[model samples]
Target: MGKEILDLAEWKSTLTAFAKERDWEKFHTPKNLATALSVEASELLELFQWLTAEESTLLPQKNKDEKLRKNIEREMADVLVYLLRLATVLEVDLSKALQEKMAENAKKYPADKVKGLSKKYDQY
Candidate 1:
């Protein structure tokens, strides 16, 4: 079957259905999902644990090892899945939340002030 283009709602519904089918919803509370999200994020970070800054930046293209690339991809997907699950459980409107967050960040880190700086917003 052809893959359907999935929006946030559809992705949330898919994850919800998968949880329901496996009777996993009982364990999918916001707190649990949040913890899972953090764990998955750590797993993703682990993929680059020993790499230098430049190596990490070049990982996606410079690494010719298909298996390593696949591992990175899978870890990234795990992080994203747990994040989406957490957001869904919290009843967050992801798109709206992202827009609001971007607006806040834009104010905090105005281009003129932060163009080449990697410092925190408070430092700007």
Candidate 2:
């Protein structure tokens, strides 16, 4: 595989190029990106609206339910695309920021008290 880029600058340029190529820059203002993110997330959630969590998990694998899986995949892509675009617009270092936030959360909720538990950090 080609070298992976972690720099936000590279991602921003990539997003800019994509927008320009498709004449989409006019539609990608920061406000529009935020709105798109919410819309895409709603579409993803619509896939599981009537199903319980257990049913939703199994629906993808049942022969009769492959359509649900396809819907899930499409909505997921929609969400991801807008997320990437939003991240680029905001110049967020997604990987580094995520790792740092996870580390902070680990300190806030240590393993000894939080293992197999769903309690809030303050409850621990």
Q: Highest lDDT among the candidates is held by which one?
A: 1
Candidate 2: tens digits of C-alpha lDDT, residues 15-100: 78989899998888789999999999998898788889899767757685878888888998778778788887777778878899
Tell how far residue 104 is off in model 1, in angstroms: 0.2
**lDDT of model 1 at position 51:** 84
lDDT of each: 0.86, 0.83
lDDT of model 1, residue 110: 96
Superposition TM-score, candidate 2 onto the true structure: 0.79
Give the range of the ten consecutive residues with the poorest summed lDDT in model 2: 4-13
Error of 1 at 123 (Å): 1.0
Please report how far candidate 1 places residue 24 from its true position, in Å.
0.3
Residue range 1-124, candidate 1, lDDT tens digits: 9997648888889998999999999999988998888888898888889888987777678546677789889988888788788888888988999999999999999999999999999885
Each candidate structure's TM-score, on Cα atoms with residue i matched to residue i, is: 0.90, 0.79
Task: Please identify model 1 stretches exceeding 4 Å from their true place.
Answer: 1-6
Pairs of residues at least 3 apart in sequence or in different chains that clash in candidate 2: none
